[model samples]
Target chain A: MTTTIPATTTAAAVPVGAGLSMFDPVFIGIDEFGQPVYLDVVYHNLLAAGEPGGGKSGLVNNICGHGVLCDNTRLVLFDAKLVELGPWRDLADAFVGPDIDYGIDTLRRLLVVATNRYTWLLANRRRKLGPDDGMTVILTVIDELAMYSTVLGSKAQQEEFSTLLRGLVSLGRACGMPVVAATQRPSWDIIPASLRDLFGYRAAFRCTSLNSSNIILGQGWAEQGYTASDIAPTNQGAAYLLAEGGMPRRIKAAYLTDTDIYNIADYAAWTRTPTRTTGLPDMGLAA
Target chain B: MSKSSPRRRFGGKSTGTVTVIEARVHRSSARNAKVAFVLTAIIVGGLAAVVATSYLHPIVALLLGGLIGVTTGAFVWLLVRVWPVIRLLWWWSTEILLAVVLLTGWVQLANHTSTLVTLVVVAVLVGVPAGIPKLRRLVIAWSWCLIVRHRLRVCFAQFIIASQSGSLPLILWATPTPVGERVWVYLRPGLSAKDLEGRLDKIAVTCHASTVLIERASEGNAAYVRFDIKRREVLNARVNSPLVDVIDPSAPASASPLTVPTALDLPDVEVPTVTLPTQAKPAGKKSAPTTTANGSKPAASSADADDDVSDWI
Candidate 1:
């Protein structure tokens, strides 16, 4: 489902808003009053900041589980911490962890592939192809984007990631693709100004510092003093949503189980052809 | 745990059962490959013969015949020296593309065909090889088995899970309604066992499954139980028991502790625990099972196994 960006309301529909496919089990919402609530929404990008035990990682899982239900979306996870997203390797399109010497290299490779695809699409004006174009929606999920940006090491790679992310955000919508980069630390260093602007949907679970809240939800959200600990009580999956043309709205993220992720993975994998199905008369080997 | 039990008499049998099914599938796939190989050969050979008679002069025919003989001889030698992949590919090329090669080879062999008798001879030459019984039966069997086996394994895996879990009553497996390349199992979670069973029945009213497995883990609990139900050979088992082990908390130092006093993080309920007997004792002095008098028992041991046997008709 498309993300709704209302023009000028005091509250924006939560980042994970209603009418989204039921990807997660638990969701956080808000009542007419500013109290927290629980409900589910679209498996979009999420950013969670809060004191420890504020359920930052839990929010990450909730978003992932929701995205797992969207068969059209492919999940390529970059989990810097390894522990948070390791158990989910089997269910993702690809995952990067601490063991890999060149995790940044892997990310670069993915970016190259994405760029090449986008280039091809643009050259061919692929938008005209409609359903026949046979494109799969890709979700480049970075669990701790700030940490990864540091691990990337090379200045060129960091800049490249930043540019690639912005390009993906700007161009991904029409292609039914999006980037989901999350970080528990809501500091400006982790959520850079450029990258923050690209994320149309923002969620701050609960912040240890008001600066992080400002970084994620803008000044108004920071004023609310939303805490991660307030998650369940405020609303089970409740988090603030900031988007283009809309005021912040609190919505809950949904909970999903392993089976849900598996089902979607299986479906997504099957929907794509072998990449080299109909043999050509020339018998060109597939790349 | 010691792997010795009197009922281990059935241990060897279980392995054999698994092997038998595995072997059957293996044999079926091989048979299919063999048949396809033969049919492809006959078709290719027949076309080659037709081309040779119609297009090759005496000199060309002799050269072509010599070439074929050399290739055959080389293949026979390669079979003993190389792996199956090389052998199979060579065989497939010889079988399916032989005709095309022969047609192309006419230019190399010498091209001359003017008489009706010559054309008729070519037709007969090709026709006889095409009708060869050895090749035709092999091809048919291989093709049929190849298709059937691929679909069979997929169906079997699903069946095994459904029958084993006894959750078939709550779940249904159906072919894609629109006939896409993908198959899906629609899951309706949060239903009562009966409601789930009703949903399963409604879905299954139009479909059938052979095996089912159900695994459930509570939200706050670390332990999970699984039930396996089988439909084909009659094996249905469930691990209705819970086993728990010590779970060391791993929270980041920067984050709040799990047992935080603030934020009202109290869980309404705690997972029940079971303690295992620590050491063996004298046959007469079976250690008195210690029971916690006031508090929940110490953390349950992490891993446990439940095994069941069934003889389903």
Candidate 2:
């Protein structure tokens, strides 16, 4: 039986203004049993990796869709290919394309914002952010993670970007800023165990081999019968998702067609327009 | 000299020496001190009575002082006796309230109503909450949490190490989760989270759980362990995006200015345009075998059989 849940939160508790809250769980897709699967996006940073044409984009887009439709939510998107996350460009705070320096600059700025938030949190004696704080949730998504980490302009710049990204992933989670990065190449140089472990939630799409699957998910998962390589190539959206402190479970990422994307983006753009007054601040990079 | 010593004898010739036993009344310093304190209080009271002799009769003054001294000692004893019980009550106030409510409620129901009626009422009380899906899940999950607490205690007793007191890890608190229950426990001195990790299967079996994942609950304390007991999986199903219903259809189309088409309505086309070439046949080539208007290929003409392209198609 297909159960249709209307919204993430109950009718009474849904955020008052135009959309949902980042504190609310975002519906990404269904798990293996056809049950609805939602991620606590604010608390969890997701790392999705698989072969080209796999469903990494599908999962990333789901996060982006939910992010754009949220109230008091800021999105910073990096799409090296430019088309995967391009639909929501008009609504994002900063949408970087094909430029390593620009991507590094965005990461550096995001780290600054994260540090500032930590300072605020320290002053208030809070370990993490809460819904009542009224602070914006910054959702930074990198569609092609390998592009900036390995294939970008210069080795020094790429290393700087990786280092800054690692800093953000570590610092942003508690500050209500989470990173959802996707890459086609799941290699050690791109995502070492140190970097991979920083992500609390990881989705391993169909990999060409078990080792690549282990790179996305932690080590020894492939041996434990949770290998993404076992997934058929035809099953594009199927993946083994490992949330922190749990075994990897198979799930199919929810797909948003181009028209759906365009509709959502247009609506988001209308909602975030400056002329319309709302609780959110003027849209830009965080202070 | 041996006879005078009267200490030892040959083993087979004489019986074993019997020692004289004596009783000694050794005074306990605490008892003596208590007695001294009481006596001092009495002496002070007696002095106060002597001081009061100028105002009251000696007999009345003496009685009053004795009464005052006894009352002070009695009050101190009563406090010493009741403090432990009061502390215990304060520690388990909630548990005591629950037990009291259940016992009194059952008694009242049984006294006022028939046995069958009482049973029915009790059933309804439990049924109403259990009938609600969310409440039912919470109740079950928390019930599992309680079960897991005892199961862990059992596991620690049987499978894991215990502290010097032979006491199990203290279950600090528990909460219900979507999949199961999360239990936080404070490990005793002899036990560590690593020790429990090795016996997860045993603990899972005792808790009637499919799986039990143990992790350090607090970064500051290694003894604090969190157990996530999974009896079922929450992520087995394909969840449809809430965005699928984000746009309401019942509302006027004007609210959503851009209409999203749900299904494609393809126009019907003539099959001849697709199957046969649109361009006119070459003038010099043999006339192609004709197809019927229904798009069914007709039998090839005997003369044009070799050049029929439709046969290959």
Candidate 3:
């Protein structure tokens, strides 16, 4: 069943800003009232899920594109369906895709980096990584995560991926690493409850059923007037975003065309050279 | 005029006047009795002083007797004034002394044992109980409840003093909540909730709280104030943060595979010489510089040692 409310008149547009502090707010989209919504990536791991053609990829691209342009942000892209993330391939510090093994290797590499970063932070008497410390923000974007999991050869491989991903999702926020995973189907097998619980922020587009919406946004969310199933299928970029423990609000992600992606990639390339000279590799983006 | 006629003339006056004269006579008789008692006391005291100094030289005895008399009199007067407080202190000191003795004996026993053995024993005794999650939570919750109660009491006392009111706001309860702790206080009939609202920040400061919220009670004319108590940030519990002792080479590896170092452990990779920003130092270290700067030799040596250790690390 679909339910639609009349959109409010105040549509404040949120523009993407340059710079890589997780504390800096990025424009996610406009709310029901048309006022632009913003969310800071610090201390939050995000999960976005919807049916095919629900504009999930567009939202991910908008967020990732903005993040890639920031001077301090490093992007790690794991695209099981390589076509969606192909435009920004040149911009990402590390792009693994089209094959499941590469994605697994990327996850393993991220786990190692996270572990070492944690150790380095502790040795320096830092509790968590922040933008003020001149540290780089590692933003990992995993698209078609369900497909990536299915491509694993064995259950052990799947479990290993789950364990490492869980560690990154659960523990990565404070170390300036945040994982944003998106999938078309948020089924029990695709995104297990253990994995879903770790994501503090959730965005749901038009989903196949209420159950899918609940799985993505949490239980009782649908009852709480945040029913993603109510969103019309044709509303491409419209979604319900729950962030920073606030109430879920309907928002449309800022659209990023191919040209926009190219421009963001150019900015990332320009910023990469100087950032790498600081002895910290801009490991998340590719040249 | 005849005597009987004079008496009749006096009786003609009001009965109140006759009663006033009788009261004055009764008061004078009481004063006379007090004076008589004081005189007897002085004589008895003089006799005691004489007995005390009887064996000394005659002149010395007189001088010593006078001294003794004055000392005894002053002590008796002071005892009479503050006997209640002395009694209370006497009872408490005895109990406290007993407790201290027992505690000291236990500490001595523990000290006599090897440090390792003592630590192991302590860990077994306290750690076992603390290891149980339910028990640990219960202990934490109970302690939190006590702490909140004490904080609320302190805030209430300060409020009363600042308000300068004869009546006090009745505190129903101070209970913990998910965000912080909440206290229910009933405002007296003459008092306004606004009086407490204005002082919420001062109360929070006194209580060492992060923030305070004052809201009207759901049912009554009381105010329910919530205190967001400040707590020390535990770095190790933070996500993606390393454990407190994780960098120590002697620490054992965690059994969890998630924490086991995988590919990043390169032997030749040098740990960066990252100097932590010293915007804020621990409270203990703030005094170290001043002490060293004063040119105390020991403090200077210790400061040098600290610098050496940091350099080595």
Candidate 4:
């Protein structure tokens, strides 16, 4: 059942190259019942569903690592879980996380900035600038979007973040920003309806509840009669990519060690900027 | 056998490519307006300070206005008459910060005509050009060396392009095909950790993958591939249900062979062409008892004879 696919861009009616799409590689796979699936052709963002210690990080790492392999795609990781994506910093252009509050706040702000950048780019005409005008694909890979949503405290914060995430997912295709939201606890409360459709490419690892699987991959995938683990020899990083027509591709998870990420940091030494630890340092430092 | 070896396996996920529009015009226009406003404000403030300071200290007033006027004139010259140079210089200039600093210094020097004013004015002059884009980049590099705690690197997205420009090697060792859909797995070497880092580096440089993948392969060369498909738009075709079956790494090889299962339903999914990033150098290493974080034994490897259909997971 292993099928090798060639890369070709058929449709060009609307411009697709101005944004991060130009910088990143798009992944195509198959669903369980032999059908085709695309990663970011028309923007079917990632949906990761698994339980605690259910290989969530391992799976996200594999996908993010593979997804960003395309030279053009840029990974901006928000690892609120601290250790999950922290190791893969080398593979990412910019990484922020472990600071739950700051991370969530930054995600919100980044969405705004990225959206502005995208809209600004779209308004530009070839009469003014060269061909390089396009949105830089910003993959905001959040380790625990569910927890972040819950920690927002008030309903408004949750709704706002949810709405912002939805905006990101809805307008992401045109703007070149895609949200790869991963969570061990998959639930309807965590993932809003706006983003539900956006997560067309759903990947379910080992889940604790059928409800979680149902919320993620529609139905029958997490039922009692059949076990996906039974059919194949699943490893830690491996999971099924669920899409409408995607043919189920049982691919091995990619492994990235800390040393490998360190190598990337070494190369990126030239571009690293000093992080402002003490912002403005109060009026005392200013004086 | 790796679950990928079955006759019905396809690609992994979708390509999240966005249609980006050129925003250079909007950006430049806004930048021009902002720069003009800032410059005007700085000039006006500087002139006012000079006029106001004349009552207190004429020497300080003259120097302050001259300095602010010169900087404004220079910025305007570069931004208007020679925009290309300014555009290029933006990569290395102090830019917005310098202007703001100069305006602030002008105000401070006006209010305080003491030695502090002279020092502040001097600092402004030096900080402007010195804090330019080039200096900014240099400072960034320096800080990275000194202050940056963790590693920072370029992600994989900067390299891969989804265009049909040239026929690069597309190496897909374990791609699954649907019943009627034709699929091709593009292969290049060096996609595994056991592969040579040098070869992987070379291919990554050549292919420009955003992030390279290193999967524990049973047997294969080290080359990364971009999983893409060329779809022939099929209407009303019932899409297949998502795979809910979990993979059991501990399962015996006899349980699942490298052949297509009879009970599985096949959907007519569009097949796309695939491309690989670059090849990696296969490092010499005996099959060590590799344990996953889950403490599971590593999957067995496939011989070169069975490389095509044998799942390398």
Interface RMSD (Å) of model 2? 18.0
TM-score for chain A, candidates 1 onward in order = 0.63, 0.88, 0.85, 0.66
Candidate 2 regions exceeding 4 Å error are A1-18, A275-287, B1-240, B248-313
**Judged by lDDT against the true structure, how good is candidate 4?**
0.45
What is candidate 1's CAPRI-style docking category based on DockQ? incorrect
User: How accurate locally is residue A140 in candidate 3, as Cα lDDT from 0 to 100?
Assistant: 91
Residue-level lDDT of model 1, residues A14-72, one tens digit each, is 12212223232223333223333433322244455554444455556655544544434
Per-prediction TM-score to the true structure, in the order listed: 0.35, 0.48, 0.44, 0.37
Q: Which residue window of length 10 is worst by lDDT in model 3 chain A? A: A278-287
List the candidate 3 regions with Cα displacement exceeding 4 Å: A1-20, A271-287, B1-313
DockQ-based CAPRI category assigned to the predicted complex of candidate 4 = incorrect
Q: What are the per-model DockQ values?
A: 0.02, 0.07, 0.02, 0.02
lDDT leaderboard ranking = 2, 3, 4, 1
Instruction: Please provide, for model 3 over B140-162, each residue's C-alpha lDDT reduced to its tens digit, 9 standing for 90 to 100.
Output: 65556556655665665545443
Mark the regions of model 1 whose C-alpha exceeds 4 Å error after superposition: A1-46, A99-102, A123-133, A151-167, A223-236, A257-287, B1-313
**lDDT (CA) per prediction:** 0.43, 0.71, 0.61, 0.45
Model 2 per-residue lDDT tens digits across residues B17-67:
342211111123234446655765687678777877778899998887777
Error of 4 at A35 (Å): 14
* Lowest lDDT 10-residue stretch of candidate 4 chain B: B273-282
lDDT, candidate 1, B227-302, per-residue tens: 2221232111111100001111121111111121222333532223221111112233222334334654433342
For model 2 chain A, give the 10-residue run with minimal summed lDDT. A7-16
